[model samples]
Target: MGHRFELHKDVELAATPEQVWEAIATGPGIDSWFMGRSEIEPGEGGRTRLTMAGHVEEATITAWEPGKRFADRTEPGPDGTFTAMEYLIEGRDQGGAVLRLVQSGVLGDNWETEYEAMKVGWDMYLGTLAAYLAHFPGRTAAPVSAFRPGAGGPDAVWAAVTRAFGLAGPVAEGQSVRLAVDGLPPIEGVVDLAGLPTYVGVRTADGLYRFLYSGAERGDALVLGHHLFADDQDPARAERAWQEWVTALPIG
Candidate 1:
């Protein structure tokens, strides 16, 4: 990767180094907190791919050290794009672990906006990773994201969302919630995560619902990724329910 741009995030988690490594290195573990579906071919130069709602991103494994580090280097893009990603695991001085991600690459002209978005995305996903380890360790995640694009500004969208999902206030970890929407089935789960202002996740007996916010000039949108039970509870139906429900929302 060229030394044009770089984005890095370091997180201290309450899990061990082995646990952190497993969460980042394994396919199913990544599914728990990342894109809807992911598969990793272990070892240096192995290929890893992620698919969520038909969108795909792939990269070649660049570094591999069990319980210590894992990295990837993506192919060059048509627009002179370059990427080198790394996940480093270290034991914390306290009784926990620290997981760090360093992503560096060369960018075209519109790099600033993209870089900021990447930062937020990394913070959100890594926060989810920490939450998954804390709440649902040793479990594989099956995820499906229901997209609702062009929903408008965050304030209006968030209000509609709270009213629709029976969320009375800002989301936080470990809060109990009850679903109150149609088209989709009933959801009852503790707030597995609530990285509010953008990310909120609910882990239920059937699966997980990870809500994501997209803030852009074109129009902000929302995506709800139902993980670990996309098939368990009628995949098509759940997505349809969400699409229908979101369509019904008052778009601002």
Candidate 2:
């Protein structure tokens, strides 16, 4: 049986509606905060494509109202399961803007785990969005991503990640962290999101780094989603360094 679900989140950003709209509706805007690389065709009925680790998924834009609203839906699968996402942006009288997100979808079998993970995932991504607007406004990031396969479930993966990064117990927002992966340049930053068993985010002066635990049910273990804002950073080199570092982790 398929399970239907809807998740809603509202966040106030320190940016204008135009800025918020650009972040949510444009390709470069999404690449800076969300998972993978994205390309969006303008206006309603157009296509939105996201590519990650050589895999691609596309959705059709269902609604498009510049600076106000944008929505997209993926085609239903064989079991009639599909995902739809909508973003509503409203400019606030005091200056910034309020961004609301509604994500509705139907999930096949393992719905509970998937739904729970999705909930956490959105919260993390939205936080990244907020960070992007507040600190790195008007800049497009060079995205960096890598996956650690065959890592055990969430608990084991979280343990290993924290252990590697020297994080003890549950990390809190505002906590300072230093990442010293052997193959990559050292990263020193502050923790921005820390939802145990699901996500950990670190924000450095030049980047937003995300560590995600994909549940065991999905057959994938951990994912590193990072965005570098420094003009001299090479995304390809950074990605390779991360990939090598993750693949060498003592897991499973």
Say which candidate scores most in TM-score: 2
What are the per-model C-alpha RMSD values against the true structure? 2.9, 1.7
Model 2 lDDT tens row, 223-243: 999999999998888999899
Residues 1-252, candidate 1, lDDT per residue (tens digit)? Answer: 223787879998888898888889999788778867889999998999988768888999989999898999878888778788998999977778988889998876767766777887787787677777876766766555677888777878777766666667776677777875586667788777666567777777767677778787424778776665344566666667777776788755
What TM-scores do the predictions have? 0.86, 0.93
Model 1, C-alpha of 22: deviation from truth (Å): 2.0
* Model 1 residue 248 lDDT score: 81
Clashes of each: 2, 0
Worst 10 residues of 1 by lDDT: 227-236
The CA-based lDDT of model 1 is what?
Answer: 0.77
